[model samples]
Target: MATNKPQTSRQQKHLAVLIDADNAPAAIVEGLFEEIAKYGIASVKRIYGDWTQPNLGGWKKVLLDHSIQPMQQFAYTKGKNATDSSLIIDAMDLLYTRRFDGFCLVSSDSDFTRLAVRLREEGLTVYGFGEQKTPKPFVSACDKFIYTEILRADAVEPAPEPATAPVNGASQEAKPATAPVKAQKVPVDFIAKVLDDIADDEDDWVQLGAVGSNISKLSPAFDPRLYGFKKLSELIKAQPKRFELEARGSNTTGGKDLYVRNRKPGK
Candidate 1:
């Protein structure tokens, strides 16, 4: 049986990270690198924009701090974005080099949709990072798409609501106040379907590692952090009704290996 275990960190992927400074915010740089490190080493990190303009001033310091190469593309005409053209050209140049296993395109612009499609056609995985308002076509083109909102350095966690007091001297149940449940970015039903599709025929239980890999294959940008969970295991644990989780001891080592399966119709 094929295992869903993730490759060792040592077998790191070489990725080319190309950022569109004009469309993406500078605040996400710190978190962005942290996120990318999970997948592999970024072999090439480059940001493109018209450096002469004051609008790109925010990226100046960030570029130096992160060791990102800034490519200047001067705007030759009004109502035209030369940055996108320059990025596309450079991406093609890098793709032809055949050095990178994947390409990380950081932009909220829909114009790069074709570029992503082309890269995928050449068997290169494309990871997209953009704002929530990014076009659906652009998001769908990439192997995985991460929303930049979850990558902000100063991202605010939702505050818990204060407990309500008893009114009119009536005995109020001292119910524990709980934080408001944030709606999951990835729907439960969608996750259930993915789990069911990937479950083994002989055993319904699917290894948590395999489940995570399958999720990434199905939706590259599907991350637990997007839904407030730090790990995939935590995300699975959060939805008890839709799924069941188990930890079985490994044969080689005494450490436990987690497995998950969709809940039965009646159970």
Candidate 2:
């Protein structure tokens, strides 16, 4: 029997999904692409790991099916893991070439926390995907942090059941737990921590562009989809209670620009 499925609309934007096979769960590999396809076209798909290892045997099928190039990292040192470094080096090379619009870093290790930061320094969008156990340093580093568990759950049940209420007119009540509400306040503390961490390493007023840069650098798996916001600006605006916005002079082209800064809750 023929089945109808929603057409996957092609996106104009281009993205790359870089997987650290050592640290990322193989089960979510398909789900990861499904999620990335929502943002843009996956023009590039690469996964880094020691392919010689028996653990990576499972990824071979996926690599062929998805046309993802497998980057093999041999053990360079006894105890030191080389996969993270190799991935970072390759990512830097890709960044300098200016090939892709965004990158998807699929790994659960904190070692990639800095790689994400570096990519953003060059002004590239990053999306991070990892398990819930991913360290705070790594979790906070990305533009967005997506727990793979959530995606796994979503895969099992794509959507929630509609709320049902009693047909009787005697003060029927709807479930409050399922109701949608306005955006939650952007965590000022979290934003401040991110700004401070990046600024401390490089002393400066922290360009608004740079803030975005740092976010992507910290987490290539971060996408605004996790927060139910289409764009970053709308997410910030939704949290006016925590963030303050400002208009700055235009660039050389004379286009108006706005900036976001973290402030005290009341200010």
Candidate 3:
């Protein structure tokens, strides 16, 4: 897994994390924090559920270790989840505070679809974490949605090939681990659509960062991991036949910016 890029104080995002214990598994807690670290600091981490229920008993120790606050909501009625309401209410309260730059909603339930959309409407970025079974509505509602299944990569993803030195300009990056979900078939058409939508034929050299941002907007659940790569640049680089990668000294701070262009025929 790639680590979070170093960010200045201004670039760092303060995020409020809200997890639906009823819908998420306890096993993902470790990987969840690691993944969340990539986006921003967890200013507030809270999980919601009925603590009295034995079904959520597995989460007890995990919460203490992560220092995550547990918000309790009783089962007001059979077959009804009051926890959802509790989480939504608390989320709005946090939103109004205007302290967080984003919200991390961890749940596999589709019920939070409106909640995600509402948060984005308030100009707050919403990052969703859920299982693959999560509905399209919920996934599309967030700014970015990560499937929890990838969090448990070791057990699910096949071992990667040995690493070699990276190439300059057009990177021949090391291959990522094979996914059990078979998402390795690169999203060629999707990439083409995003390129066409963002860059015209004359604008061949589009910054990779801008391309990535648009990809998230068009497909919130689109992740490089799904295509068996750790980063978008690598995913694009892997497709030498379809795309051309360029690295421009790009930043004053000595960071190179990667650029992409659709591979022209016979070149």
**lDDT of the structure predicted as candidate 1:** 0.84
Write the residue-wise lDDT of candidate 1 on 1-267 in tens digits: 999887745238889999999999887888789878877889999999989999988899788789999999988898788999999999999999999889999999999999999999999888899987899899889988988877773232344346678899888776322212343565787788888898767668998888887777777667677676778898889888888999998755678999999988799
Lowest summed-lDDT stretch of 10 residues in model 1?
Answer: 175-184
State residue 87's C-alpha deviation in candidate 3, in Å: 0.5
Candidates 2 and 3 compared by lDDT, better number: 3
Best by lDDT: 3
How many angstroms is residue 208 displaced in model 1 relative to the true structure, after the best TM-score fit? 1.7
Model with the higher TM-score, candidate 1 or 3 = 3
lDDT of 3 at 162: 54
The 0-to-1 C-alpha lDDT of every candidate, in the order given, reads 0.84, 0.71, 0.87
Which ranking of candidates, highest lDDT first? 3, 1, 2
Ranking by TM-score: 3, 1, 2
Top candidate, metric TM-score? 3
Each prediction's TM-score against the native? 0.82, 0.57, 0.85
Residue 203 lDDT in model 3?
Answer: 60
Q: Could you tell me the TM-score of candidate 2?
A: 0.57
